[model samples]
Target: MAYGVENALAVCCFMTPEYQESKNCQKELLYADEQNVPIIPCRIRSDWKPSSWLVPELPTKQFAHLAISNKSKSGVLRKTFLIGNTHKELTRKTAHGNTSEWTFFVRPPSSDRDSIETYIKRIRVYLHKTFSPPLVILDRSPFEITRTGWGEFEIRVIIEFQDEWHHEDLEIFWNLTLRDNESYEEVDVEFDSYL
Candidate 1:
């Protein structure tokens, strides 16, 4: 188990009383932790809670709950969008000591690109007050806002849609960082066909 965990990209542990109490399971989880491997805790029994010792071993207290039952369901449509930021240090610095260029963007999945582009009318980004024009409006695809800054701050983004879509404006907040790194958040939008 240790060898497998070491080689695996991620380990999915089905949490249960039996699995938690096992000495071997404990060792495997510890080993995974030592090696910096990602552990995905899944709760198989609805009534069971992770043991005290097990709680600290997992990355976060939140786990995916899997309730097994006999039921029938139909397919549902889902769309995922990637919202994130990328930043890089610039050789040139501003008078206020700003030294990095950062860009925050919202990218829809390839399959839904056309539909998202057609429905989204514009994007509004609100930056920190220190910026000359704190609010920016983008009226095209590749919704993004790029600027140079020296510190990290929260940015508010609003996605406006065409009137025909009849959808409320989507508001999201992103943390803008001044570093040579990139991060993304996955936003899932589910739609009911009957609606």
Candidate 2:
């Protein structure tokens, strides 16, 4: 929802029903979070207030994308999907009884070594969760590219749900690891979640 790099941010705070932190408000929150930029929270209960951080700036030339759809028609809140730089679109739908079937349009940027391992772990998680939805990339299975040297490349990431339970847990427990680029072996692992 933000348009420029000068005043851009992402709200990663938690909100209480007594104080609803709607999606619209988070965009502005993230903007101020950059560079200890001194942002006032929405004054909600349970918001993740940060004491400080080096400002994370959005790219000026290459803009980032955000695909966030908050409640379903029944008002059940779902997941939030964010990629630093990627293009996303909902591709196909099929009506069955009352619910709709789904396919997604995903084309992510080729990640550098800095984020490749992180991305791969996420990809593996999605695949296991959704059992590998009809991937947009037919020839190649979801894989990672390791950078042995100094260079950056973009890649695509796709996540599709098998049933109605999409990736919409307001807070999900997920596992993460840092690995060697070439070996793809886990160097470190941790489990954490956000709400």
Best by TM-score: 1
Q: Provide TM-scores for the models.
A: 0.55, 0.18
Question: Candidate 2, after superposition: displacement of residue 26 in Å?
Answer: 44
After superposition, which runs of candidate 1 have C-alpha atoms over 4 Å from their true positions? 1-77, 110-115, 191-195
The residue-by-residue lDDT of candidate 2 on 1-195, one tens digit each, is 345434444334333332233554445555554444444333222323322221232222122222223332233322223322212122442232212222221223334223332322234223223223422232233332221112122233443332222232122222221122111111221112121
Question: Model 1, residue 47: what's the lDDT?
Answer: 61
Give lDDT: candidate 2, residue 144.
29
Kindly list the per-residue Cα lDDT of model 1 for residues 1-195, writing each as its tens digit: 767998999888877777789897788888888898887888865667878888777746468886543232332345587888999998898887888988988888666645567657898989899987999998887788788888899989998876544457889998876654888899865432211
Model 2: per-residue Cα lDDT at residue 50? 28
Which residue pairs does candidate 1 place in steric collision? Answer: none
Sequence-dependent TM-score of model 1: 0.55
lDDT of 2 at 42: 32
Question: What TM-score does model 2 achieve against the real structure?
Answer: 0.18
Alpha carbon lDDT at 30, candidate 1: 83
C-alpha RMSD for every candidate: 18.7, 20.9
